[model samples]
Target: MLARHHDPIAAIATAPGRGAVGIVRVSGHGLAPFVQALLGRALRPREAHYLPFPDAQGQPIDRGLALFFPAPHSYTGEDVLELQAHGGPVVLQLLLARCLEAAQGTAGAAGTAASVLPHLRLAAPGEFTERAFLNGKIDLAQAEAIADLIDASTAAAARSAGRSLSGAFSEEIHGLRDALVHLRMLVEATLDFPEEEIDFLRKADARGQLSKLQHMLATVMQRAQQGALLREGIKAVIAGQPNAGKSSLLNALAGAELAIVTPIAGTTRDKVQQTIQIEGVPLHVIDTAGLRDSSDEVEKIGIARAWEEIAAADAVLFLHDLTRQNQPDYVAADAAIAHTLAERLPPGVPVIDVWNKTDAAPGVQPGSAPGHEAVRLSARTGEGLDTLRHLLLEAAGWQPAAEGLYIARARHTEALRAVDAHLMEAAAQLESSGPALDLLAEELRLAQNALGAITGEFGADDLLGVIFSSFCIGK
Candidate 1:
């Protein structure tokens, strides 16, 4: 990715569709000649000029707005040219080709035999934002937040991503790193004067500082977990016997006829999925085929696939048919399925016991049963759905923070966990009868590195490649 940074890049910045207007963005150093060849005159910096975008034959391709931003003040911290033209796809493609041709012609007119400007090519995914990071305009976390904001599925997630893009997450990480650095400085100083009789850490109350830092890191980790839930969402599988209203529950939650619901048993021969948000947290709900022994080959395959989805789910909604609970066969089948669920589900994955068809069975109360946390509801009538939604949030360990949250990814949570682990080791080192200051300092340094990686202060080229490549081109 770094090797191509020196080359000028261009791409259609807008989404691939017809709209009122489209944009073609060019970014790199020394774009004055290319701008002149395309626009026929130098554009005023930061001023919008109505001009004709020309082709290789000096004919107007489209008349629209032309804006130029000089180096150090633009998004990439380099010279940038934006051409707003008609939104037709073909028109945008032609304008893009004309820009490249103009670059080639401009280089030839300047008599530069070995010029790289003529080699201007289409920008790869996320090249513009990568340049912004390289130019120190934004950190790695903020760059990721830009992509998150664009891809957010819910209002809360979008707001959190916006906060992250504004550097809220980076600022918290930086504050933790600064505290670790301060402690490291004190510990390193103690090592330098080992002959001194006075204890530097004890005099400076380093242990107290370490305690406070641990508390702060825990707080950040909690918020990061909630942010991750908002970003990645929860995968919930609706599992139960045949005709337990799993499909109806999915449709009710989604507020659309996303899944086919009927009285016929085994209507769903495969997994039907939909994503819905409850209180601004996305819930990826999958209504799988009924779990049962079947003679039909296709139904058998679907039943097998249902188990696969159940195993991978973050939460499982075990819907029971309240009207059929009195039947001997139904009771036996429910017990067998419950045993399978206990054996197959991963440890720590929660299962919510839901009794459906309550509209037909009004005498049954909606509360916990013996040795089970249960919610009785009618999927057909939408009764007790509010309780189910709140229960889902509680099972996922989601807590609304007093302050606004910043969107975070799984990698961010892992990094925070690493920092917390190192801090724990440092505290243990301090508690030893004869404190090992060297080990303490090493833990502090490790903690700082893990924390710094969140904001790109400590990262590798390959990691950057993986992070930025997920972004849309021309971002």
Candidate 2:
């Protein structure tokens, strides 16, 4: 995978289907010969020339506009060729095959002797953007933003991804890196001038510099947190005993009849999920089967799946029917479900007790679930649902949509957190009386490395493979 980038690559650059126009793109070193051989002439750089893209017999496959970009001035930092043709799968496929055939010296007619390009092949998914990163045209964060922009689910998400692609996120990472590098220089210099170390440290205000960096990192982390929330929304699972109005709550929240609403206890035997956006943040809500001991084999499987979803959930809504709050048996079953939730849920997962059917029992005062706040609502009438929405957003730790927010991945936030940890350790070493300068220097060094990983300065090959492989082809 690491060595694949050295080869010239070709692929259809447009979306699959019938459209007004489609494009076949090629990129690599010395693509001039390939272009001259396929198009029957050497075209000027960066100019669109109307030409006939020919097959082996000098047969015109299609007449289209061809644009050429030379090395160091293209999207992938290599020579690039784009053929704009009529939008049809067959035309694009034939054009791509002809390009490959000419490059690989497999064309039967063999009209041009100088047209063969050595090591030309098809591009892998994201290989174009990966080359851009590898050749210093963009950093890892910006490369990732290309994918985020293509996959953005909402307008706000698309805008945020655009910001990231333009280097807003990488700029912050680079800022941290620069600051960290400065501190490391100061710490390392102390060893070179040991006799003046005490006076130098006092004059330079190392402690003050460290404090400022920590503050800057704190602010950056908060922004990244918001960005990550926008990029990867929270997963919420709605669960409870039989007939607690779980499906009704789903319908009310989604403002649609997504899940079937019936008095029957086990109407939903599998998980039903819908993604709803609140203030540009996506919330994936899931409705699970009614929790109960049953003789039916299917219900048992559903109950088991519910537990699995709960275990992996970011938040859970434990639904309780307001009318049944007074029944001893109903209350006991709710308690048993609560006990299982506590035992099975991972630590830090929020559970919001939702009391449903408020219209059915208007006089019943809903008690909050123990150890957590409760939201009382009638899913059928849409009462108190707005309150529930706000609480779920709070559980997700999302703030009001802010200005200049950039989309970030889970890895970006995790890397920032790791940098923060190292900075904290360095701060401790700086504060200790008769501090060990070596320890302080090591911490700062590690902190910079962690920060560098965000922009590919310190990333591993496998990490690159995992990141770029997720991108759409021809990007």
Candidate 3:
């Protein structure tokens, strides 16, 4: 347990900027003394008291609403006080300073109560939410959902995070755990009564239960993969020869002139990145320097960086200039780049062949040709862009879930995979000629532990620290 939980923590909860209102929040045990010292009166629990927030000199610093939530009923399961004031940065800072002063007995004799509010300090990042987790107000997954909701980049992602925060994900995990516990009980009972094991095991249907659990686990794992994609968008690298309309496609997809485009072969000498959403699935489009031999030292460096990006990308779009495809030199160059891409790109990373400038090269058909699967589109005229969008989603193996998804992280997906692996091992044990109940029971236990880790029911302190530290303070 963290010792700082005993200390009172205060911070400016609202974002730092000029707004109609700002809030200074404090959380700890027994905040009545501090509240009385700051507001000059006791506040009714769960009630908003419109009053003057006075300073040490009994001067009204700013009049705003003061809301108080008593212990066991507040966000952190402690006494939490929120002072809403003007959103000016200085005003919030002054209010925060006064809060610290009042908590530390820095005011006059009337405010001296060190025992009531001892060790008043600033909160670390996510300490407030961490306290809520520790106090059982929310579990670890829900706490993570709090941060995910705030950082959501899309409407779909925000909704998913909201669902997860509402304990949708935790409830599912708990339900699965309960089922595992029931199975474990049955298996262990058989071990204790070997004489009656045959009839007991037959009636218990351990194999059938395990199969059902495995199926359910697979379903959850699939949903988690989609949620993880929403949280961490796919990185797609655009690579091709110089003047292949890579920048043009980026600008068209983004619906803005984000990247400078020109007819010059080496116009884009560096990577130009733009994130665009197709059906709430973010595609981080990286338009890299065109691949080709160049005497310009800077262009060579850019080309090298482009290859590096391609190697790390989840997908690569090899754009081809349709107008120049008939030329022998251009064809040879395109073939050479294609050969290099096949050799250099990481295995399993999909590469999409895109023929650009379809408007200039009319009568050219789109779709799979002799050598590659291609999508022909005119980035300038906005033709065949929708097909490319669908293709990108398909290449990433993204299938739109029929039901709502709970926002999940990479770690959640990894844990689910671990659980699946253990379940597979357990299934293999059950199918053996002489089924080993001992080994099957151990495998189920391992699976339970892996699933529990998702909700912090069986997680290390270091894992909790890493998760919470990523959140902003006052959460």
Best by TM-score: 2
Arranged by lDDT with the best first, the candidates are 2, 1, 3
Tell me the deviation in Å of residue 78 in model 1: 1.2
lDDT tens readout by residue for model 2, 1-475: 3577789999898889999899999999999888877887989999999988888888799999999999999999999999999999999999998988888655455345554787888889899999999999999999999998888877878899999999999998888888878878888999888788767877889988999999999988998998888888889899999899999888888999999988888998999999988888888899999999999999999999999999999899999998988899999999899999989988888999998888899888867766676888899899999999999888878888478999999998999899899999988887887778888899998888888889999999999999988977888
- The clash count for each model shown is 0, 0, 0
Error of 3 at 342 (Å): 2.8
Where model 3 places Cα greater than 4 Å from the true spot, the runs are 113-115, 194-199, 366-373
Model 1 worst lDDT window (10 residues): 107-116
For model 3, residues 1-475, the per-residue Cα lDDT tens digits are: 7687788899988876899999999998889988988778999999988988888777888999999999899999989999999899999999999898887677464455554566889988899999999889999999999999999989888998999999988998998899898988898888998777656867888889988998888788888888887888789999999889999999999999998988888999899999889888889999999998999999999999999999999998989889987789998898898889888977888888999998999976544424355688999999989999988888887887546888999999999989999989988987777778888889889999998899888889899999989988777
- lDDT tens readout by residue for model 1, 363-428: 865443344557888999999999998889889888854368999999999999999999999999
Query: How close is every model to the real structure, measured as TM-score?
Result: 0.95, 0.96, 0.95
Q: In candidate 2, residue 180 scores what lDDT? A: 79
Q: How many backbone clashes does candidate 1 have?
A: 0
Q: Candidate 3: lDDT of 116?
A: 53
lDDT of each: 0.88, 0.89, 0.87
Any idea what lDDT model 2 has? 0.89
- What lDDT would candidate 3 get against the real structure? 0.87
